[model samples]
Target: MDERIGLRERKKQRTREAISNAAISLFFDNGFDQVSITQIAAAAEVSRRTLFAYFPAKEDLVLHRIADHETESGRVLRERPGAPLATLRAHFLDGLERRDPITGLNDAPEVLALYRLIMDTPTLAASLLRYRENGKQALEEALRDKENLPQLTARLAAAQIMSVQWALSEDNYWRIAGGTSADDAYPAARAAAEQGFDQLAGGLGGFL
Candidate 1:
């Protein structure tokens, strides 16, 4: 029974990866707005229903990985060993050092192309906006009892913190997109991240 379950999980993973690869190839060749779900299904050799099962939305075919880190801020606030703000700061700084894609510091050719594709495509940008919004709300909930602050203050703090990260990441992406190597951009990324979090903590001292 355990073997059967493991086999089933492996098959599911393969299907998901196949779908993502097919959809991305199609999107790369034909541009995002010009492609349809049926076309992607055909390219992936999966029925439209199966494709939807693996990914609820077509936009997710390329952006699913980005969604993975969206909940991290909430987790930090909820399970902090020290100051929640400090934990969040350290987490992003770690991403910067590691050249995490979410931190927009990855200089790999494929990563740059993928980032450009998202920026050039309207639907993907909108999907990313939704993801960021969801992350903000999650952080807000996490911050509710986090600092024992007023409700309005919690909401404001969440917004500010999320915005800081977003702002720094966007700046990094722009630099990389403009031909700056990720290594060349590392200093700015690290400085921006540190300053952003420091400003957040300074402005809202409850969490610090």
Candidate 2:
């Protein structure tokens, strides 16, 4: 029955969350490299086999936290009404207002710690880069399919938009990480995002 299936899915989600939380806590306490699958599995009270079932690789145990957001921009473009760039610009600004971690304008201690962990770990950093590249590809597809853009145009616009987003996020992250409170940095962060999008609009021109 559907009820049984729903319960089974909820149980799986809980198990996955427990394993992820345990892995992150151990990584934060003892460094990512120091933590092992067996140790995380034991902490979560799950077998190593169960852990692998949820997260196929060690890097995934950490990166899975953000996997859902990998195609978020594309999803936004596909679902929201308006010109593609305008929708994306509005979404980024709205994320800033909401202190979304993806915007890199959040100052929560755990958020900052997780960012540091990713930046400090080479393997995780590399994995994140791959995620960003995948995000770009997804956006390209959305542009072509939803917005009716030509293939080359979609590819070019997606690259530009992704680069701008990356630059803006990095700037916001460093500002907050360097001791500026998110509330205090909001004005500059908002301004930077506006400018980044404006520049994108200028570069893409009629296409957007």
Q: Which number leads on lDDT?
A: 2
Model 1, stretches more than 4 Å misplaced?
none
Per-candidate Cα RMSD to the true structure, in Å, reads 1.5, 0.8
Q: State the lDDT of candidate 1 residue by residue for 14-76, as single tens digits.
A: 999999988888888899888899999998899999999999998898898677877779877
TM-score of every model?
A: 0.94, 0.98
lDDT of 2: 0.94
lDDT of all predictions: 0.86, 0.94
Clashes of 2: 0
Q: What is the lDDT of residue 92 in candidate 1?
A: 91
